[model samples]
Target: MTILVTGATGTVGRHVVRHLLDHGRRVRALTRHPARAALPAGVEVAEGDLTSAAGLEAAFDGVTAAHLITFGGDYRPLDNGPRIVELAERAGVRRVTVLGGWREGTLEPALRASRLEWTFLQPVQFMANALTDWAGPLRATGRVREPYGDRKSPPIDEHDIGAVAATVLTRDGHAGRSYHLTGPEVLTARAMVAILAEATGRDLRFDELTPDQVRREWVAEGRRPDLSLFRAFSEVDGAGQADLVEMLLRLYGTPNELATTVTGDVERVTGRPPRTFAQWAADHAHHFQP
Candidate 1:
């Protein structure tokens, strides 16, 4: 069966494509720029935009299953959900997996009302955020300055997210389920820093930042350079960098059950335990080197 993967070049989408290829399935990757996608050989790269369903006919053609992202470019939730669902239904697609955002988007409602088999992959914070948030500082000074040093969460590896998505899309009995995916263990920012330090053999320190200090630093920097997921906060109209910074600080500083809870959904779906933060750090240690 040919499965179409949207966001085929994204962090998790690339993994999905890889796992699907490993399973020896026909994969069609949909992207706005196929030339820049750089997907693996033997996969069809189709140029299409999820925001505008008018051009997705060829991408969905003959596809039996598909993966989707709730957000479009700049992490803004896609508003043309009904149209995309209509196109998918018309194309004879049978299954779908959505990598959801922090909040529900237009796509969920449309999918819920459709006849297609659907599963939601609600993953916690991605462990890859450390590369964007801490790697630069560690490379320069061996220090990770951030707020909420004690806030805990089981950040899942992006690879597991991809694996779970691939399994759900290819298998049956996953329809109408929403899996809250997470890593195998819970850890705080400081603990994660220590793990990275061990992986890189460096004395990395976690310097906790106060809310006001984080604001000042963010203002000075003029952008939220820490995590790509924070870009989702900019989806609001007229929301500036300062607004995004505040939203991120609130999210990281505050305690939330869903953010901190560890779940076995990844292992349950993929038949293997989710990778730990230390494992992730070890694998990507070279990126943290000076």
Candidate 2:
């Protein structure tokens, strides 16, 4: 099966390509710049734009299934989902796995309304998102300044997200399912910091930040958070640094059963347990070194 993996160079998408390759599936990695894709040797790097239907149509050729992101460049919403679906149907593509949600944009609705097989991979939060803030600071000073150090969450590994997507894309019985995936354990921010410190053999500290302080930090970063997108604790302007941190604080600190809960969805689908945050820390220890 020729599976077209969109956002193929992204954190999760790259792993999706890798997992598919491990399963011995033919993979076509979609990117705007094929020359710079740098995917595995066996994967086909196809130049395509998710926003442009004309560009997307060509990539759908001979593709049996697809792994697509809910949004496009700059985390922008893809409004041309129907057209993309049309092209896919025309090309006889059967199954698709979306890495986001239906409420985010028209893509999910379009996919659901289509005759094609669709599965939604909704992860609570990515463990890799920590590298965004902690990596640079740890690399420079072995410290992190963030809010809600006491806030707990079960952040799923990016690799697990990709693995689940690969399973849904290649195998049967996953269609029409919206999986709310998570790690095996719930961890507080301070606990995660301790793990990282232990993994890298360096002393690390988590300095709590007030929400106002984080908002101010966002201003200093020259990329402010868009309050309109705050429903998901998402920011449109930034890499969602402030928004996501605030979200973690809120989700874990409060009595919100949804975010702080752990589930076996990953293992249930992939037939293997989800990796823990400690394992994630060990794997990313290099980023925390002084």
Candidate 3:
């Protein structure tokens, strides 16, 4: 079966394409720049952008199943989400897997309203955040300073997220299911930092900051950021300084309340237990070192 993959170069999409190719599935990758898509040798790379509805016709052609994303260019929601699904429906695409972030967009509703088989993959947190939020700081100063160091979440591995998507895309019995994927256990930022210390053999530590301190730092770092407060920061972009600080306030703003819970979805879908945070740190320990 020919599977059309959008966001083929993204964190999860890269793993999805790799898993699909390893399984011998024919892949048609859609990216704005096919010349730089840099997919596997056997994969078919085509120039297509999902941000606009104009050039997706050839991407969906002759594809039985497909993978899609909720947003378009930036972190904003897709304006052409409905049109993309409509085109996929007309192209005889039977099954589809949608990779979504914290919030739902027009795409989910459009897919639900359609007759095609659809499954939504929602991952709470990515273990890769250590690299973005802490890795640089750790490498630079061996220190991680932030608010809400006690915030707890079950961060899933990007590979596991992709594997779950691969399972639902290539197999049956998962349609109409909204899976909340996470790692094997929940961990607080403090615990995660301790694990990093062990994995990297460094004297890394977490320093708790107040909300005011974090907000000031975020503003000072950026030229002019539109800072908004929320009960919870749910977007998956941990690198976003504004969102990170706000999320920290919401997380540490309260006491002993987990923003995300643990789930067995990964094991249920892939028949393997999700990887642990320590494993993630160990796997990426080389990156932590100078």
Best prediction by TM-score: 1
Model 1 agreement with the true structure over 94-206: per-residue lDDT tens digits? 99999998678799999999999999999988998888778898999999877889989899999999999999998899999999999999999899999999999989999
What TM-score does each of the candidates earn? Answer: 0.96, 0.88, 0.89
Structure candidate 2, residue pairs in collision:
none
Compose the digit string of candidate 2's lDDT tens values, residues 1-290.
79999999988999999999999999998899987878889998888889887678779999999998878775667888888889999999999999883248778889989999999888876898678657878788777776568777798999999999999988999999989899999888788888899998888888877867776775456444333224344424463565565555565457667778998899999999999988999999997786
Model 3, position 236: C-alpha lDDT score? 56
Candidates in order have lDDT scores of: 0.90, 0.82, 0.81
Clashing pairs in 1: none
In order, how many clashes per candidate? Answer: 0, 0, 0
Looking at model 2, residue 41 earns an lDDT score of 91
* Candidate 1, residue 102: how far the Cα is off, in Å: 2.1
Worst 10 residues of 3 by lDDT: 223-232
lDDT of candidate 3 over 210-272, digit per residue (tens): 777768866565532222222124235454667666565665667543346787889999999
User: Which runs of model 1 end up more than 4 angstroms from their true locations?
Assistant: 220-224
**Against the hidden true structure, what lDDT does model 3 obtain?**
0.81
